[model samples]
Target: MTFQNIFFNSQAAVVVFFVLSGFVLSPSFFNKSINVRELAGFYVRRFFRIVPLLAVVTALSFFYVKSAFSTWKVPFANSWFDGVLAHDVPLSASILVKCFVGMNSALVPQNWTIACELLVALILPFLVKACTGRLWLAVLTFIIATALSFIAADGGGKSLPVVYAVDFVVGILTFRILQSHDKRYSDVFFYAAVIGLVGARNMLEVLTGQVDLPFNDPLLSLVEAIFAAVIIYGLATKNHMSRLLSVRWLVWLGDISFGIYLVHFLVIVIVARLMTSFLLPYSLPTQTFLMLIPVLAVSLAAAYFAFRFIEIPFNDLGKSLQRRVRTALSRG
Candidate 1:
């Protein structure tokens, strides 16, 4: 299939994820006025949710991924974080410190989004305050995110916190929209998903006319974010696709999605290597399809293990603590 023909999300998946984060978080985080303990609990859960697994993944990358893959030369300019989020320096302690603190550019390049996500989390309450019932604020956030997309392409945009903050705020807006209306789906909503899928699939090719896309184009990002929002919103609501999304297997996938996202790249590398080494298919698509199946399975399996072991335990602990805290507060 042509790149345009392929119905994959590519980079926009991250955008969708950020939107989903906002949508999922808005009701819970902003439904009522914020309180200190509530904010504290949010932070506690958010911290445990993101940091611990990230630290483990970073350590693995530093020790295993880096050491095992000689070809994995360090990415550009994540040089040193001695005292700044961005700077220049030697490589010796850079990866360790950068990856540990969730700074962008590391063994797992995808952590770029994680860095952005964490930054958004830091000011999420303020964002919630600004955006709740304020359509203008949400639109402003989207505009800012799009503007940053331009800066991103020019350079240093991806590392900037504002870019992802827009995405998370977009997510919050999605939740508000859902809450605004009943969680019902119209055929128009299905059409929305189709448009989103098409937009996501062919976005770069269509927008850039087969030319390279600038890193951060505000307009392009907004268009893509719209697609992402439609697709995610469709799945979340009771729409034509609701049954498919509601399937137990898919739900399970969603649960372990974090682990899969974190580990899937590594799995892909391993699986692709194994496929090329053994199968050596002639067709690129054939090779991709063959490896993709196993890569997904392996990634899912690894994620499941991690979810059950690392993520769930801590998540459950955080939830339990929050519950107790809530119970105590209610009594008081």
Candidate 2:
């Protein structure tokens, strides 16, 4: 894929993720103190929202490639299994143990982010409680975490945890801005975010050796900060931009976006492999584009179905569990 297409399709989607996350989590952030019962309920809901659908996708992947299973090897070998069990079914049981402990080696690669998101949710209550609506401190923590991630990057996986953390914190910050009803700052941030994204693309190109640059690291950092700030601002404001984001369709996409993101990669990879197997004569980019069409259609359809059947039911179960626990604790 061309750099521009990749940037807009993937990187920009990540920015949208940050903004949507902020919008979703703003309420909890503004509460200042996390109600433990509520926090538990929220996490339970989130878990059900994600895991079942992921499990289904993982299973599908395994079945699709079951014949190839025996050929798989160590380290990156399970990448072939396609099914959730085989995905987690490591070359050995010791690997399986590690997977259970959140060192997940899954059939679906995108699941790494889900694991990170779950980790964030587990600690969110404490984070919200500690920050106590302090936006600056939350932002600072994100900056430090991101910086550490850059320093420790092992082909970008090391940075992902920090990036997700920043995304969650951006959500919290959005919550704070909304609670405070800070319009002016939101307006400024909105425009600044747009500018930052444009600049970041140029800087990323330089870092990737697609372009020349001086002082790339510091410039990239500034761009990221601006992008993050804009996301927070967009979610926080009541301006026209915010209203656009709140549009029903966009909001719906935002709601299921997590599922879409998780499932899309697998869909694409599977379809691409199938195309290659069938000896499709199309160029790589053309085939990639064609593959994406069905991938998007199928992934979205599956995600919606998953949201209705799997995510909703499990979420309700979590809430039910939380209520029962709360009642028992209250009596104690």
Score every model by TM-score: 0.79, 0.73
Give the range of the ten consecutive residues with the poorest summed lDDT in model 2: 69-78
Per-residue lDDT value at 152 in model 1: 60
What's the lDDT for all of these models? Answer: 0.66, 0.58
State the lDDT of candidate 1 residue by residue for 116-168, as single tens digits: 78877878876776777578876776666567655665557445566556667
Q: Name the lDDT of candidate 2.
A: 0.58
Report the C-alpha lDDT of model 2 over 148-176, residue by residue, as the tens digit: 54554444554455555655555565555
Superposed model 2: Cα runs more than 4 Å off: 5-12, 15-23, 32-39, 68-91, 94-102, 133-164, 184-192, 204-222, 245-248, 273-279
lDDT of 1: 0.66
Cα lDDT, model 2, residue 287? 62
Best by lDDT: 1
